[model samples]
Target: MIKKITCNNGLRIISEDISHVRSVAVGIWVQAGSRYELPQENGLTHFIEHMLFKGTATRSAKQIAEEFDRIGGNINAFTSKENTCYYAKVLDHHAKHAVEILADMFFNSLFDPNEIEKERLVVLEEINMVEDTPDDIVHEYLWREMYENNPLGSPILGTEETLNSFTKEMILSYMERHYTPDNVVISVAGNIQEGFLEYIESLFGQYKSVKKPVKSLETPAIKPIYTENFRETEQAHICIAYPGLSINADNIYSLVVLNNILGGSMSSRLFQEIREDKGLAYSIYSYHSSYEDTGVVVVYGGTSSNQLNELKTSIFDSIENVMNKGFTETEILNSKEQLKGNLLLSLESTNARMSRNGKNELLYGKHRTLDEVSETIDEVTLESVVDLAKEIFSHKPAISIIMPKKVDL
Candidate 1:
């Protein structure tokens, strides 16, 4: 069962008590991400994520690492377009110790001047690493084309100019605005110890931010523009994207089912046709990225520059076929069953449960039972999927391609 408690300061805690497991996973979710940043502050949230691990008031960075190592616990954090999470998984006996360490990192990070300069260089190298990889950097170009001038289009790893300009004062100011109690959620899953909830509350509940969390109202309008990057790479990377639904869309299951039939699996149409049948590409897939107010479905393929046209043509043909003919009853059924199976399999992990509960609480503030989700997946019919496909495919897709500089268009 899942339980929730809101602290006096407005921090929300959600947990699932799985008494059978001997491990516990705890995540601290904050609504601080690239999307909330001003144009000048792009990647600030991700930078802050790195800074939190450098050192805290009472623990050196190495000490924090050693403490987790001592308990045989796993500790890490990630920054996304929508939020940031710092999580730890440990044996249930070490749960309190893990939480204390996380709280220390969260509330007491020094963000020392020397550390900031060193980490800035580290992040610059990270950015350069991505720039050197064509396949990875192509998606960043796609977002720039799709969202145009919106902050949503900006990369989570800010550019060198912005990174160099970020001062300690700036970091603190951004946190003061977005890292409020109301914008944070603590999610715990697995064999929760007695008084664990109170323990967490005692650690996280007292602190409160005076500033209200600010969200950007600038909704990104899709620009179905074709953009290309010329790189001296062996293969041409391409991404075809269509506008999709929001996280809370009612027909989200239908879209998921449709994506599966298109390119989600090895048996999927894009994989079977593009890779297996024609040998056009080795890596080809489709996925949906849904946000709060809107989403996008992207089909990605990488092929030799000489075969780039064929790859692009084949992908379009597959999408056109699906839109024109729709999916068979068997395809819809199998996709739904596959999704249900994946969902069931993921529940065995405390980490997965912690993440799911954390994201759902952070985004929707509601939880659906396993049966409820399975039922929703089961309810996705062929007609619903086909209709959604038609609607999604009707739009002019935004296209992004990265090709060898010598390959002439």
Candidate 2:
């Protein structure tokens, strides 16, 4: 069962108590990410994620690491396109200490100039590493071409020019705007102790933001343009994307079902036909990324340059077949079962439960029980998925490809 409380200052705390487990997972989720950044602010959200672990007013970076190590707990953080999360998994006995350290990092991070310089170099190298990775960079190119001038298209890692320009004051100013109490959610799951909610409230509550929360972001317009990057890589990587539904769309379950039939699993059509049947590509898959106002469905495949044309042809043929034939009732039923199985299996992990509750509270301000979700997935029918497939495939896809410099398409 999930319980929720809203602090006086507007911070939200959500938790699910799993009595059988001996561990606890806690996550501090903030509604700040690359999409919220201005052109100049590009990667500031991710940068702040790195800075928070550098040190706090009372704890050195090494001490912070050692504290968790001493407790045999795990503490880490990640910045995504929509939000940032700092989380820890610890034995139930050590939950309080873990939460205390997380709160310290959250409220009292120094963002020291010297540490910023060091981390900036580290992030720059990280960017360089991605650049050298063709498969990874190809997806980055897809977003760039698909969203064009929108901040949604901006790389989460930011450009070297922008990264070097960030200042401590700039970081603080950005956080001030997006890190308001109302925009934060604390999610805890696993073997929660009695009074733990009160303890979290005491730590996170009472800090009022002087500024109003940031305004809703402008929706990005999709740009379906084709782009190619020629690189000295062994294979050609391609991504074909079409507009998709928002996170709250009524037909999201249908789209998920369609995506599963398309390329979401090893038994998926693209995987079977493209990789297994024709042996045209070793890696091929499709996925959907849904945001607040908009989303995208992307199909990606990598193959030898010589086989790139055949792989592309095969992918298009497979999608066309799906649009023309739709899916059988058996296919839809099996896909629904597969999705539900995956969902239920994932919930067995404390970390997964913590993340689900955090993201649900952060995004929807509501929670759905496992039964409710399973029912919804079951409600997805052949007609719904078929109709959604036609609607999605009707659009001209934005295409991104990275190929060997010597190869010509």
Candidate 3:
């Protein structure tokens, strides 16, 4: 079971300690991401994440890195459409140090002007890398096409204009506004000390702060947009997708089963039929990505330009098979087992448990136990899976295709 504590400033902290473990994973999560962006503020959450590591008021950039590395611990972070997380994993002996460092990174970030300028360039380069790779670029384009420029469809990396226009003042203001305790969750797992609660309480309890209203987001009327990028690559990377469901949607579990049976695993139909059977393409997969209020089911593969039509045919045929025939009881059971096993295996790492609990508390309300999660996965039936398949796969999904300039289909 996980214990919950509320800091003085109302930041909720959840912790789970296991016996005999030599390490602890701790994470700080903010319930904010691209889904919360304004038309002009697309990538600010992700940018702010990077800026925190540059330097804090009490620690230099190099000091931050060296300190974590010196402790023989690992620290990293990520920003998604619905949340941002910063975490560290350290030996149980360093538990205090881990929490202190995690807290310092969040509360004391300097947001130095020089650092902001440098990191902007770094983020710009990251964006450039995203653009240069056709496989990556197509997914972003698919979102824009389906959502028609809505915040739900916006790139996690703020657009070029917003990234270029951001200033230290902007970053600071955004942080102060959204980084309030009410928007934060702290989670720790494995080998924790009971005193850790008091430590966090004493540190954040004094954080006397008031609430800031979070900006509201609206999903756009569904519109489909498609464009072809003529890049210089041997095989065409064709990606197509449409909106799925936001996180916490009742249909989420069904979407998971549908995605897995569709192309999530190597043994999935997409890999078996499109690659193993016909030898059509080397990479083929379908995934249903969920956010807080919206999501997208993406299907992708690479093939010779000459095989474009054949590839399209195979994809449609696969969908048709799922919708009409669906998966058998054996397939459904195996898929659920796959998902359950993946979830259980992931928590073997202290970091994964910390990150998972942090996100759950921040996004939803409580972190369900492993047994609860297992039960939910087991509850997914073949009938429910088929219902989801028919409901989702029956639609005429919007499509996007990318290929080389010189290639003709």
Candidate 4:
């Protein structure tokens, strides 16, 4: 069973006890990310994520790593477009230690000036790495084209210029505004310990601050723009994006089903036709990125410069066929079963369960069980899937391509 506790300070703790596993996965989910950042503060959230592990008031960076190693566990964190997560997976007996370390970093990071300068260089190199990789950078370009001036379109890594401008004072100020109790969720799954609830309360309850509600995102009204950059690479990278449904939309399940049939798996239409039949590309797939108020469907692939047009045409043909002819009953049923199987299989992992709990609560203000999610997927009918396909494909495609400079268009 899953349980949630909201402390007096407004920090929400949600957990599930699974007796079968001896490990527990704990995550601190803060409702702050690139979307919450100002234009001048594009990558501040991701930057702060890096700084938290640098050190705390009582622990050095090396000490933090050694401690987690002593516990025989894992600790890591990531920043997304809408939220940031710092998590640890450890033996059940060490849950309190992990939580304490996390709380220490959360409440008392030193953000030493020396560490800031070193990490700034580190992040600059990170930005260089992304810029050099065509496939990775193309998606960032696609979002920029799709959302235009919106924060949602901005890269989480920010630009080198922005990274250089960030200071310790700026980092502290950003954290102060965004890291309030009401904007955080502590999620845990697997062998939850006795007295863990009170232990969590004691650690987090004393820290108190009120946060303003997240500002509403301005919807982008820009038309789809095609971006092509001439580069000298062995293969041309392609990324195509279209508008998609939001996380809480009624048609979300249908969109999931739609993406699967389109290019989600090796057996998907794009994969089978573009790669298997035509022998065009080795990597090809479709994905849906759903945010709170909006979402996007993206299809990405790579091919030789000579075959780029064929690959692009084939992708569009696949979508056109689905939109006009629609998927057969068997296709819809199989995709539904596939989604259900994926969800059920993931629940067996403590980390997956903990992540699902945190994300659902943060995004929807409620938690959903595996059964409930399966039912939601099952409710998607072929008609609904086809209708959603039409709705999603109705928008013009935003295309981003990076090709060799010498290659003729």
Of candidates 4 and 1, the better by TM-score: 1
Q: Which ten residues in a row have the lowest lDDT in candidate 1?
A: 400-409
Model 4 worst lDDT run, 10 consecutive residues:
214-223
| Model 3: colliding residue pairs | 43-158
Q: Model 4 has how many clashing residue pairs? A: 0
lDDT of 3 by residue, 1-409 (tens): 7889987678888888876788998888887888777677789999999988988878998998999899999999999887888888898888888778777888788888898889999999999999888888877777777777577778999778999888887776777667788888888888887687788777666674444847577866456565677776777777767567778987688789889989999989999999999999998999987766677788899888888778988988998999899898888888999999999898887887788888888878877888987888888888888987887766668777778754454
Ranking by lDDT: 1, 2, 4, 3
Scanning candidate 3 in windows of ten residues, the lowest lDDT window is 204-213
Clashing pairs in 4: none
List the global CA lDDT of all models: 0.94, 0.93, 0.82, 0.90
lDDT of 2 by residue, 1-409 (tens): 8999999999999999999999999999999989989899998999999999999999999999999999999999999888999999999999999999999999999999999999999999999999999999999999987888888899999999999999999999998899999999999999999888899999999888968888567787678898988998999999999999999999999999999989999999999999999998889999999999999999999999888888888999999999898889999999999999999999898999999999999999899999999999999989999999999999999999999964555
Off by over 4 Å in 1: 406-409
The TM-scores, one per candidate, come to 0.99, 0.99, 0.95, 0.98
Candidate 4 CA-lDDT value: 0.90
Against the hidden true structure, what lDDT does model 1 obtain?
Answer: 0.94
lDDT per residue (tens digit) for residues 138-194 in model 4:
898888877888999999988888898999999978887888888899999989889
lDDT winner between 2 and 4, please give it. Answer: 2
What residue pairs are clashing in model 2? Answer: none
